[model samples]
Target: MTSTKTMLTLAVATAAIVAAAPAAAQVSGIATAAPDSAILSAKAFGAANTQIATTYKAQLDQATAKQTALTTQIRTILDTNKDGQISQEEYQASQVATNPLSGRVKAAETAGQPAIDQLRAPAVKAQAYAIEQVALKYDAALQAVVRAKNVNIVLSPNAIQYAPPTVDITKDVIAELDRQTPSVPIAAPANWQPSQDTVTLLQQYRQAVYMQEMRRAQGAQAGPAPAAGTTPPATAPRAPTGR
Candidate 1:
């Protein structure tokens, strides 16, 4: 089951939207904050999202249609008997040489994947460009939020088993990020590339978005959906600490 922290964190923290840096502050009391959430919530992220969405609307639209068709095609193979769900036997069979349908199923998957990827590439790139921009400003935002909130000990939503609502300063952190960068450039040069950290952050952001979707859909995730290009991070920024 998803905890309130994870749910709440994931709700706003899509794309880690990534996480903030390890907090450096005086310690006085304990508080919980999801820096990942804050990073996603920044105004710049929103602005970038709008810009990217506008720029890549056609690609996104194509992707949406392609994804739906792919889902149907894949579902037919996985749910061979139309049982409404894919059984382990069916899934395993689809991958092995034993089933005659295996070759066809594999073929379908291989053929459709590239087409879908190509269609979504432009939008995906734009999304990444925007998210990386937000990540660049995350450290400063974390510090500002921690100090302004007078939080001494800050923990990730993932770390806290339980905490009072008041201690969850994810919103304040986001507000700080907004103040830091109201907007960022959405376009990336052909030579442009994100750092490994930004790449990881983008992944986390996607995972969080997936989790959030599962919660919303009751355990069913759709596709490579966008969540403010979520601040995905393999190593999210740490929250500030108070003495």
Candidate 2:
């Protein structure tokens, strides 16, 4: 199991590395989008998440029902004192005997969790991979928008002070992302390893990317039009520059 986890981790690390390659400053910024670029809202991704949530809710219901049944059985066993009330001592003692039954139920549930997880794994994988692909697609679209605008820097919509709605290509990129595939490919073996630095780098990169997405979503929720000519609020101070 540990080996499997390690392998899966490595595969994710690899994908993340590949994704980050294009972000290097050296990568050519020669993209182009129409002058009237669409603004892509982060909320658009929510459209694809309903199915995933439904799947998880069903699994949780099953788990909860199983737990409820086990609780009833345990209660019945502890009601042994016949006083219509389970004494604390009785409850504690009965717990040991009832524990096996509970354990059995739990073990079964625990065992079943993996199966349920396995069943859902592919969908989850696909969703994540698809999200990444969408992000990449957005990146490309944004680059084009910048090039067409004749801008050297493609500032995040939130970061830019007062760009015209027409100048913000966020919407167009999001639409394209939605139309594109949103499934993660599951090639990770149930074995794979790389250097620790690689893993750390991947984790950091993923966190940063997630933060960026979150900020974009927050900005989208906070307004209709950005305040004209106002830069993004100052970000929290960063750690001292690294080598």
Candidate 3:
């Protein structure tokens, strides 16, 4: 999941709201402090998510192709009767018979998982680290801003009205992160099992594709059933009978 800026917590009710008066009025007493942290948070989270998204796309494509091929192979094996199809009963029975060796299939099912984790895990960890680094930078910058304004409490942008352009600190935080971190690859686990969710989803998808093919083959074999009540035409007579 993508990260988000921290939530705002401030009492805006007691704060003064400045309404525009005639140009002659002098503005005074209203105070505001911009949220540099929120800006930094947005930038850091956005960059991390973008990197993660690209990684996820590649992993998803690879997994999907592998799954499609395996489904076709499994379906061919299951429809063993070759009457062009298998009934649900036939399919279930075949699976049961073959189920004794399912450990092999499970191993295969688990094979692609490491690649997926290799793409996803590093992205997650990198984003987490980047978030921490950026937060620290934001706090340091914020303290300076606070000391300059002599404000003890600073609320996020959502809590205030009309912050000056100088108040946003996101760019600085992003700059620091960009300077310190580089994109890194996720390493595969030594013995990571396939995610159950991914396995289950692929299984269901393959089952649907298999069922469709079975139905199509059945349709082809079902052709014209002996033309209603008429008996099937007999084979031609043997030549010269028993000469």
Candidate number with greatest lDDT: 1
Task: Please provide, for model 2 over 133-232, each residue's C-alpha lDDT reduced to its tens digit, 9 standing for 90 to 100.
Answer: 3343554544444555554433333332344455445555555544553432323233323233323332343355446755785576642222111111
Reference-based lDDT, each prediction: 0.60, 0.39, 0.40
Ranking by lDDT: 1, 3, 2
Which candidate tops TM-score?
A: 1
Model 1 alpha-carbon drift over 4 Å, by segment: 1-29, 82-98, 159-163, 210-243
User: What is the TM-score (0 to 1) of candidate 1?
Assistant: 0.65
List all candidate RMSDs to the true structure.
10.7, 17.0, 21.0
Model 3, position 233: C-alpha lDDT score: 11
Tens digits of lDDT, candidate 3, 1-243: 111233233424323222333322212322343333343334554565466557556654554455445544444444547564545654555445356334434454466334443434444343334334444444454455455555544434455556565544445434444444433323324443333322332233334444565566458775311111111111100111110
Tens-place lDDT per residue, model 1, 90-155, is 666666677666676667757765676666666666667787778777667767777776655556
Model 1, residue 17: C-alpha shift (Å): 29
Model 1 is weakest, by summed lDDT over 10 consecutive residues, at: 234-243
